[model samples]
Target: MNIVVCIKQVPDSTQVKVDPKTGTLIRAGVPSILNPYDHYALERALEIKAKTGAKITVLSMGPAQAIAVIRLALALGADRGILLSDRAFAGSDTWATSYALAQAIKKIGPADLIICGQMAIDGDTAQTGPGIAYHLDIPQITFCTEVDSDGTKVLVKKLIDGGHQMMEASLPALITTTMPHDYKAKYPSFLAAFHAQDKQTETWTAADVNADLAKLGLEGSPTRVGRIFPPPAREKGEIYSGSPAELATKIVEILKKENLIK
Candidate 1:
């Protein structure tokens, strides 16, 4: 079986800042980490590989710095890696980004399965994976928390708004994973990391992927960021501890005072 996992390098959100002038992230000097959800997705793929002897290929797109995440994936037992890096890919929105990745996947050859995180923390717009499915004309399942396969069909546990559902799909399908609430990402050991450095990794450009030049970057993006600003700071809240009746009365009075209720 051949499995491909799509991963991303993202700024540590807690330490990231937005540039007000450009409406862009201030990536300068911001430490990057593998997108946490992608970590879980990779772990799941590795587990499957162990059972089926599948070859796992880690695929990602970003600046050269993104190579770090690919190396991490290889160290953690991925068979190899592919990094899609090109100046033409900068500022690509979900649509263009997915198009580029779908093109690369075609070049890499057909995959029995393709996996991706439900969303990237940096963008939080869970559209890329589904967009890739659209571009490739493949069926996909999103928000999957678990997956199992028997080489021809895949079974998955998928999350929904109120609960989750079990689903099955045929081979050559795509799935997007959602990490468990308590999921803790794993790192590679020293020896494993050293060995991973010797593993194969290819860097591809838009032209190499045969991507249309007009749809490779910001110009191809339909969504434009007008501006980005932090939400207004919230004021402290007053806490009242009392019996239910007393609390209810106090809440009513406060709501009436604030004209929130009649």
Candidate 2:
């Protein structure tokens, strides 16, 4: 089975810094890590491969630096890596991103199953995966907590409000994952990391993927960032200490004073 997983390189949230002047992430000094949800998606693919012997190809789109995440994928067990990077792809929003990736996936040949994280940590927009499915004109399942597939059919445990649901889709479909809380990401051994360098990675440009220039970058993005700012600081809570009866009276008075109770 040909399995494709889309992963991303994201700023390590703990060390993220924002540029005051531009209202942009300061990625230069901040450390980069594989998006944790992507890691879990990749791990899920590996788990399936363990039994089905699927050939996993890890694909990503970003600057040249994003290859780190691809190499990490190879070191973990993906058979190959495909990096889509070029000047034209810079400053792309989710719409343009999904367009470019859909084009690239077309170039990667037929895929039995495609996996992606439910949302990116930095953007928190869960739109890209569905966008890919739309661009590819394929069926998709989102917010899956667990996934399994035979060579022909894919099954998933999807998370929904108040409960979970089990669903199945045919081959050549896409699924986005929301990993379990106890999920742990895998890192390669030193030797495996070194050998991962030898694994084949094909780098493609916006043109190589046949992405329309009109739909490649900021020009293609309909959404604009009006302004970026941090959230307001939280206020401190009040405290009351006294006997139970006194505290009850105090609470009642405070509530009445606020017109919350009478």
Candidate 3:
């Protein structure tokens, strides 16, 4: 079975800042790391591989520096890594990025399953995974917390509004996963990291992947960033000291005064 795990290199959210004038990220000096959600997705792929002996390939699209994340995936036991980098792919929105990724996937050969994070930390659009499925015309399941496959069909536990749902999809499907809040990402050992250096890793360009130039980069993006600014500071809450009964009555009175209740 061939499993393709889509991962991304993202700016550390805590250190990221927006350029007030350009409404763009100030990535000049901020450290970049693998997106945590993608890391979880990769781990899930590894789990599936351990049981099924599936060949796992980690894919990413970014600048040359982005290969760091690919190597990290290699160190974690992925079979191979592919990096899609080109100036033409710059400024791509989720739609364009998905288009390019879908094209690259096709070039990589048949994929039995594709796994991705529920959303990227930088964009948080949660659209790319489904977009790739759309581009490939394959079934997809999103918001999955747990995933398993037997080389023929995929079984997943997906999170829903008030509970969870069990879903199954046939081969050649895609899934986007979300990890628990307390999940800790695993690190590769020194030996694994050294061994990863010898693994098969290749860098491909837009032309190499046969991606449609017209559907890549800013030109292909239908949406534009108007502006970016910090959210307004939150107001402090009122504090009161009283018995439980008194507090309940006080809350009722306040709600009534505020017209929040009749």
Q: Of the candidates shown, which would achieve the greatest TM-score relative to the real structure? A: 1
Which candidate number maximizes lDDT?
3
lDDT of 3 by residue, 1-262 (tens): 9999999999998888888889888888899999999999999999999999999999999999999999999999999899999999999999999999999999989999999999999989999999999999999999999999999999999999999999999999999999987899999999999999999789999999898899999999998888877666689999988999999999999999999999
Per-residue lDDT for 82-195 in model 1, tens only? 999999999899999999999999988989999999999988999999999999998999999999887798899999999999999998999999988988899999999999
What are the TM-scores, per candidate, against the unseen true structure? Answer: 0.90, 0.89, 0.89
As a TM-score, model 3 comes out at 0.89
Candidate 2 per-residue lDDT, tens place, 1-262, comes to 9999999999997777777799887889788999998998999999999989999999999989999999999999999999999989888999999999999989999999999999888889999999999999999999998999998999999999999999999988999999888888779899999898889888999889888989978899988776666666589989999999999999999999999987
Off-target runs (Cα >4 Å) in candidate 3 are 232-262
The per-model lDDT (C-alpha) reads 0.93, 0.92, 0.95
Off by over 4 Å in 2: 233-262
* lDDT against true structure, model 1: 0.93
A best-first ranking of the candidates according to their lDDT comes to 3, 1, 2
In terms of TM-score, which candidate is stronger, 1 or 2?
1
